[model samples]
Target: MAPRNDTAEPVAAPAGAAGLAAAAASHVTVTLAPLTEQLATYLAPADVQRVREAYKFSDAAHLGQFRTSGEPYITHPIAVTEICAGWKLDTDALMAALLHDVMEDQGVPKQELAERFGGEVAELVDGLSKLDRLDFATKTQQQAESFRKMLLAMARDVRVILIKLADRLHNMRTLDAVAPEKRRRVARETLDIYSPIAHRLGLNVLYREFQDRCFEAMYPNRYRTLQKAVLSARGNRREVVGRITEAVRAALPAAGIDADVYGREKTLFGIYTKMVEQKKSFSEVLDIYGFRVVVHSQPECYLTLGTLHQLYRPVPGKFKDYIAIPKINGYQSLHTTLVGPYGTPVEFQVRTRDMHHVAESGVASHWLYKSSDVSLNDLQKRTHQWLQSLLDIQRQTGDSGEFLEHVKVDLFPDAVYVFTPRGQIISLPRGATPIDFAYFIHTDIGNQAVAAKVNNEFVPLRTELKSGDTVDIVTSPASRPNAQWLNFVRSGRARSEIRHYLRTVKYAESVAFGERLLRQELTVLGLELPESTDIAWNKLARATGANSREEILADIGLGKRLAAVVARRFSPGADVVATTAAAVDEFVAARSAPILIQGNEGQSVQLAPCCSPIPGDTLMAFIRLGQGLVVHTTDCPVARRMRAREPERWVNVGWDENPATHFNARVDVIARNERGVLGRIAAEVTAADSNITHVTMQDDAASSVTLHFTLQVDGREHLARVFRFLRRIPQVQRIVRIKG
Candidate 1:
């Protein structure tokens, strides 16, 4: 870790200077004794004892290790436990938090936790363990996977994420101890994951903290500049808030409302983002200040809002009443930005006592439940339900990479509050579609998604929902996902479902293709083929990386890989020599299964840049190792042009299908550059019912347009249609298929 310069420019800050300062600050600890005493004020004596014992066990298990800042390793867990204690979390969460990192860093077996604690503790700890890997590789693949695992657990029992956020917050706060090069990644993760979780959970306080910490660590210089700007602004704005507060305090007294009003400045990252987004200096950012007004009664909240509006000129389009339609994370506040003294804008948040509590705690309702009339047993049940969800999603999905994507995408910070026609508000991750809304409402609605009504207008399921948009799903028994559904769906559940359906569809399609190919071979053997059975072959096929039998055939069909190669593996002793591919190259396309005409496998076959292949061309396939096989044309100037050069890479390949389905074979047409000539040529193609994929006119500036149409239709005949049709057009020109 290094000391950040906090300058506007990118420069290296001395690491040791920063490390020492952080070491001093980490001394602030809310230990188990005070934490348990706090819990005892609300929980039973037995429960406090249990929590205390859990802490001691965790402390002993993690004895002797030190953190980046040289603090006792116990301090970190204690900090995490203290945060959870604030949440007044249940026994399992508390216990898990105490021992979360033991398994991964200390190599303490999960089985030990399972036996000592219960399966619940072990599971929670395991979910926490999954988060540790995020600190590894900087690759998106690794980060995405790590994010996925954390989210899956979060979705299961939001606590996993809550505990993880606490861990992350402490990390970010002491990020100076980590390498400077590593700071950005940690900051990025914090912003992408932890901050979003705080926002999602309605933990505005934690959200702001996590975001600021990440922003600071990632851009220490920028952070310092921004910090200085904010501090300077605060110093200047003190009188402004005091005046506003005095006015509000006087107004509330006259209105006979009992309220607690607090002035809160915008967090650093929030201010920094606004400045950057608006491209203004910190001083140029006006209206970056806000106040929270906590009232006892809901009625008093409206009264306070009115009094505030009367006190200052209300800024149009800057008011939001979350009380009417609470945020997805159950945040309820009446927000307004008003033009105050000197026409400067000031923002105010109005909320009831309950909302205030939820706002500070975020999703940690333990604090609320402890004081509420609700029974502890009821709280226990909710915790259980939430924690079990992680297990469900984990059981359903095992791919670490995909799991991370789902969490980041599905469990996001921002949210859209939409409604059903009946006006039931539903909160969803931002950028979510009606399809996600449908699934959120009910699985069957998702399975049968047919059409949707957004604000009573029929709309596509893929439409992104907006706050206050009323969404109504139109589903039918006949409605089911096509492969295209995966294209626009935003929900993890929907995506997973679509992928599963597509995989099944492809497998079925592949099975039929494989059997057809097998029959074609057996038929060539002069024996009637028997029906193929058992799905075990598809698994083998997939493991071998072959998709459909055609793909397998295409490999053999193009003579890239010998059919005997696959046949021998799938079924023994299938004829090695008589395959048509052999004739195409060594057979047709290639002789070697893993062949290298030269050591040029990784280089692009780049169609020699001389000839471009259009849709309908006499194409050939070339086998190359690592780069897989490449498709080329028999007469591509690029291919022929290259054959004259590197003759080794010039392997033979013919169309897998005799009348090739579609290919982009280029044709160099020397024509007098004339207007109707291209039209006439295009007319010939239109008449042929084949489409040209591309047209590249040569830059010779000659009167003739060297047209390249990557057209679609049966191979050579398709090209002949363009040639023959053009021949009759009187602007008749000679045409030749270009290959590479």
Candidate 2:
């Protein structure tokens, strides 16, 4: 059983205030002395001394500082430390928790902390400190960067995130004292980011608290109403809960299965979410109470489950054997829902005592190095694997906002269990594809994935995998990841790897294009392009603020720098400058023969979605800052508007005579609002050999309707073919292509 810390109680408040009073009552604030005593229960005496020293330093550093509750700010860190101590974290983690706010609030130097404490403790403190003072383009960007930095730190040492989560938890608990607007913002962020992270880490206790607190802060009246409703229901359902508990206890002991049987209620926030998501009233939300059976061993867990199922009729499709294939967070249990007495649905979880500890405490259950077990080691290895993947993602992803997006997508993994050819169970997120499965098995396999077989039948790599499907991935040494995989692959690791590979390939292509453009211009100058003698190009690189000549040329290819300016700088004299000027005009000349498009340039070339320009279209290119060349149709209204405002940024571009891939085109269809209008339009497109990617309807007009479609076509000719087919339809009033 987990020990309770009495000092970690919420602030006292007057009675009859309802939710606000309840929040204030549940808010925890701990003092230094009791926190130290709690640490002494698990930590060594020497470690306890270190924690005391950290408390004194943090307390002194935060002197004269108070929170919105008018309490000394030192109380916050102590409370955070107490939370960590409850997890049985190491002394370094406890010390770091105590001093987490000192550097941010008191401007203490990290080097000084390192010298006073150990380097690891100081590093953890530095990781917990926020980057609020730094400049950013926006607050969202700043937040993303802050999370990115913290996640990277957490990747290095998991203790950083554990402490950070505890800190956030305490803040959420005491959020009622803050201003209303800031309080709501904090609560929403806690729900969006931190709560999901807590869930991912398997910190169920903190996860539920964070969710319930955020729900209360975000919607106080609703929370209060729901709280009352739950209270009333608990009153009405008391006898049922009692009877069920009694039945389970009696059955377990009578069956000679020694177990700890208890009942647990779902979190109020969880109940509220179900009500909103399922469109159910509070009364309709059955199965509010669940029972847990803790046994001595794994076999006993199964036996207890069998006993419970025999006691009550098992609800079909409500049984899940997580013990056979544990959750990603190392949570193991047998979950089942049963139709109990009075026809109420009762949920039950059967696990061992050790499994229960991990289910509640998660990674923190194994934080003590001296008390390691196989279960704890498995938890540590799994956590370290995820953390190491974060480091890999950080290396592949440079943009903080994008990194956070990927991490967020990965956080809430509703997993599906699949099987390899050899029957090894592999768990992946729901809606994951064979590509994700391939990558989960190995990066090399993902990169080399040529084809896949599901249940001995060949399937597309984009096929969404279902549970219990046997998947086999075929690989070839010559194969590499296709950029299109980014559109369908669901796992963060696979997405990151595909993007990293594409970026690398793009850079290499840019270098080659830069070399060709520069060499052609030099040839026009009646001068030979110098080799990488380092002396000539190195001087030019220095003049251009680029690290090397290659980078300068790549910038020219990427349209970051002007080739004209580079040529002028590279010219030896005025005569060469005039010659370079002549070559610039030649380079600017619009021609279909010289400019080629193979449709394989990853990021360097992008077909504008506004016009959906395809092959054999009269195309022009506009270079946006930081984004490479954006190809647009010549007559596109959006392109015309942009060109009218910024004519200098436009350049000559043309499609290849034989382009390698199809393009997306937007088509508008106005037809009589009949039963089969959409079907006829789809059939017409299909007859014209086009694929409709997306469809949307404008309004519910009685006689006429307008439908918009994004379709794949070979070129402008193919689009015209589809349009002609649509115009021939009898019910079609009008059909036009959308350029913007």
Candidate 3:
């Protein structure tokens, strides 16, 4: 934090001291000299050469182009690479980091990098490239696309994120050079996209750094104000830290536990966000600093926690034992927020050496143990478990934006370290409800999820789960997950599963709808749907992304996807490949029932008095998507007349096979005012076993009554029987089915 010394500093402008200082101030240079020594001390000789080559190549490529702040652009790459180098990334990753932006900003082609550096390095660069033709029209769209890119790359290899983080870090550090609006934009993006990702990956240090940097740019005035206050308050804070640090160290050693104690300051963004949320000032925000006690082993971590609790009273409901229940992001620690000096809540985190390493370096250190300090063999073994979970969530997510959203919520969860009744730890995202925990156990359990028992007490599914509470996800095979649980699910896996379930249900419905329409059309065409027809339709649908023949019929019949356009074109019936027109037509013709109606009351079909369908209607039949059938008289124009134009698409749709939903059709009757007419009409309809939902009567030298009636029927024939029976009422003048 100290400025450069006399030797490095300019006594007099020794040739180009002003330019160098300006360059230093501009890209806001950090001392890369410190990182170079650190890397040489860590990397093997062979790997060192590759890392060196990347530095050389990138430095040369970015030679003349200065950063907006005026530092040679080479410095930006070096600084970013320096951060990645600290993460001990492989030589290929380090190389990619060095050249990450060359493809996007410079005219450097991806091919040249592939030939020169190898495909791995080139592919990494290409993955990091910005959308080539992005119009940047809306910030929201641009952000969405950027998030999509990062996620796709992160899915393949996490190293891309590490490089991207480092790049963003450097950019944020020098954000002052950008326009004020641009600064805010970058800050917002960092907060929204990158910070959460780092947290999800368990890169706690980087996550906090990203937030603080962004906070500084976004709220410089507040940052400066708080910083000055913090400087003045340092004396009091140091006294509290010293008192707690001494007490914890003394208690741990006495309890036969050897540990290293380190103090942690809450990040600026963390403090600010809490302040804004709680409507509190900096002084009122207690527990703003914490202490980490790194022990020698897992058992000692617990013993040390006990010893610390004995020294200071533990705060109620402020403890989390993550050592027993590791976070989804692979973070493990024992956390206890205690009432320390002056009754202020002071948080303490206890961890083993390895847990501390994973807590800091995350998966990176787990892959290769360069440090003489810590072993991450446990996290290394569970790497596949984490990766599999990520892959599972991704597989179920249907879209990129959705996938990214779930990952952010679930992966980098503000965790609830819950326990099974058996004390098995389950870390769920913060705000996860009990139902989310249900699906986490098994899909069938979730699908049949009904009620839950948290600690043997029946709790609502929306109950927010807490850390350390033993939860038993009580499920019955008969119990079912509610569509409403989607509002509370916090896990990516759970959320994705819920969405998938809903989508599946919707698709099934769409298929059923399509099926009903198809059956009606075939009936209208005097074609019987063959036994083989359903299967063939489904197969054709699968090929064309349709679910069934009905969906195809519905699509074609409704003119949504165009039925005739996809009619196998009906030209020569020749599809030499799969699904020829001849095969389909033969299938359709052979199944022909050639629907014939035995006329009961009228020569032509009329709109039923109930569930009215009028002329010029664009209507379609609904098969519950998955359940029973209902036909909507499409737009207000009604259906019967439009049926004449394409009689083939209308099916011999009777009434419900088994009635589930009630249908009410409106009847508007006009007559010269007659008092007994309405009563007589109602009696006749009631005799037909039809019930009216409502009856409205009006007078204007004539009477009009609009009655919505409900009736049970097998098909149109049954409906015709009701109509003919009701027609016998003498008081009824003219009855017409209401359209729409």
The global C-alpha lDDT for each of the candidates, from Candidate 1 onward, is: 0.64, 0.79, 0.64
How many clashes in candidate 1? 34
lDDT (tens digit, per residue) of candidate 1 on 523-622: 4444444323435345444655766444554444233444323443435443323333333333323233222122111122222334444334445445
User: Residue 737: error of model 2 in Å?
Assistant: 24
Model 2 over residues 1-740: C-alpha lDDT tens digits?
00111112223343465444345335545456787778778778899999899989997887645565656567888888888888888888989999997887688999999999989999999998878555788878878888998989999888888998998888887887777787788888888888877877878888889999999988999999999988898889999999988888899888889999888999889999999999999999998999888998899988888888899999999999988888888889999999988999999999998888888878877764336543677777778888888888889899988888778767874777899999988878778899999988998999889889999988889999998899999897756788888888777888988888878866776776666556655555555677888476776666556787778667756767545445544567522222222233343542223345555554666778788888877888886644457888899999999999977677777665668555788888888888888988899999999988678898648899889888989887888899989988899999888887
Q: List the candidate 1 regions with Cα displacement exceeding 4 Å.
A: 1-36, 43-46, 114-119, 130-156, 374-398, 421-423, 434-453, 456-463, 472-488, 513-527, 533-740
Please report the TM-score between candidate 1 and the true structure: 0.66
Error of 2 at 709 (Å): 23
Q: Which residue runs does candidate 2 get wrong by more than 4 Å?
A: 1-31, 368-374, 476-483, 517-528, 534-548, 555-740
TM-score of each: 0.66, 0.75, 0.67
Best candidate (score: lDDT) = 2
What is the lDDT for 246 in model 1? Answer: 92
**Model 3 worst lDDT run, 10 consecutive residues:** 1-10
TM-score of 3: 0.67
lDDT of 3: 0.64
Q: Say what the RMSD of model 1 is.
A: 10.5
Quote the positional error of residue 393 for candidate 3 in Å. 4.5
